[model samples]
Target: MAPSELRPVRRRLDAHEPEPEDAEDIEEYPDDGFDGRVRLDPGRRGMVALVGVGVAAVVLAGWFVWRDHPVSQPVPALPVVVTTSEAAEPAVAADLVVSVVGAIARPGLVTVPPGSRIADVLLAGGGALPGTDLLGLNLAQKVSDGDQIVVGAPAPPMSSAGASNAGTSGGGGSGGGDADDSTGKTLSLNDATESDLDALPGVGPVTASSIVAWRDANGPFTSVDQLGEVDGIGPARLEKLRDLVAP
Candidate 1:
């Protein structure tokens, strides 16, 4: 080889730069980070984007429908009640017992109902004797068991019509006639008829008939207290008739 035509040899650099003489044969391109072999067509890319949008729209529409209309829950039921039917018991009546003494007939222990007053006890033990003075006695007081009752003694017999001749009726027992209110004379309970008794202040026809019925059933009146047994004759009525009639 001629010395002029022979070229000097050059060492390869660490950067691996091509030799100046070989640079003309090497092809150059832009610095963009894209592989030419992996490129996609514009039509294929547009179709893929459209498919993804359609799937997202369907998912969003399904979520909205589920939020608007929810599932319905079941309703609770009510409770029932029950009752019982039973019979009631009956009440019983009670009685009282007490001892009685004094001017009353058949003085002894007697049985009476509860809430019996002193007058009731007296009536239970027969009527008091005639002319018996009952002063300062509580005839309306209630009584209980095991009590002693003391009746008032008979007062001395006196005459309302003074200086009048005594008319003896039967066996030393003086019997006065019917009432003569105009003459201030009292009526005799033993002999007075219903009509005679009905003429009094408070005694009506019914009371008069009851008095007669009582006399007929129980014999003659022994004392004014026996009038308490007659119908329609309360303590006030008996008090009104006390001075109007004599037993």
Candidate 2:
């Protein structure tokens, strides 16, 4: 065979070539039987579940404590009620019994309250008779309980000669008219007649006669205090007699 006509002969390999590995096939390796991965067994899984349940129970307990234990609030106190009553009034005293005498139309015991005046007693005795002497008498004077009020008769009109004679004898002396006029001589218990004595407070005809008899039996009184020694003369009576008499 000519060299030009000879064909290229094929070469034969002694060993077989390895197949190429793809990137996806290399990453998809199966799990090794002896790897360090953690595994939860039945007991370990139960422990984890119990821890979760314990945490839930703690949260529920805390919520219950918060709901039950609220902030403290102060309670308001109630007001008290008070009731008041009115006071009672005091009672008034009773009236007193007194007698009026002198020149009054009617003279007798009269009912009067305490602190009554002489004018009140005189009014009770039907007022003074016409032309009775009211000089020197303090009609505004207050009278005590059981007091005696007396009115006096008017003096007779005097002539000049008679007045001169009277002035010379008993009219001008210390125990005479001038003295009597100055010291309430219109009501004289010593020299007065029964009618005049009867004209005194609390003195009737009988009491006037008794006073005259007593005066006749006794001596002239030295002081007005001696009037209390007479019968029916008490503190109340003495108080009335004090104004009408002189020592």
Candidate 3:
């Protein structure tokens, strides 16, 4: 063979021989920490940043969902009441006891209601006798729990003609009814009846009735001067009867 043909064959053989690795493909770097982790290249760091951004977006989406849909809470309750009732008692009234005597039909102790009047007590004792005097008493007045009603007994009724005859005739005459009956006898002021009072010279039946009414309303006259208190009996009439009557 010629020298030119041998040179061509040697060049072809050199072209087939293996070349050295690139610096980027396989690199030797110092350890960044004691754990032996190597520092990453720029391309690897970029890929890690992309992964972190994706995780942050996922966390933000979860937070927005939690804010929109809130959790629920509980409530409370109320209370109650009750009541009861009972019956009440009733009230009672008391009675009044009183004593009655003197000229009443039946004189004794009697019972009446709490607010009874003197008239009621008198009626309970069987009412006043026919000749009993009521002029000195106030029958309409209310009575106390313990009371004694003594109805005064007036002198028996006398005829107007007999009273006048007794007043005009003198004593120690044959026709005189009895030795005790006298012409100049003074009449009793406290016990005289209407007919006995009419025997007075100036006193008529009307005046006698007025005197009895006055004694009933205001009680018995304490003195002869009190006779003037009657409706028709004046000072002159009182003087005329003053010497003839005695209380």
> Which candidate leads in TM-score?
2
lDDT per prediction? 0.67, 0.67, 0.69
The per-prediction CA RMSD against the true structure, in angstroms, equals 17.1, 14.0, 16.6
Give stretches of model 2 more than 4 Å off.
Answer: 1-86, 153-247
State the lDDT at 168 in candidate 3: 58
What TM-score would each prediction reach against the true structure? 0.28, 0.38, 0.30
lDDT tens per residue, model 2, 73-130: 9988988867658666678888867667667888878888877887888887789999
* Least well predicted 10-residue stretch by lDDT in candidate 1: 154-163
The C-alpha stretches of model 1 lying farther than 4 A from their native spots are 1-184
What TM-score number comes out for model 1? 0.28
For candidate 3, give the lDDT of residue 60: 99
Off by over 4 Å in 3: 1-93, 153-247
Report the lDDT tens digits of candidate 3 across residue range 23-56. Answer: 8888786665757756556598898998899999
- By lDDT, the candidates rank as 3, 1, 2
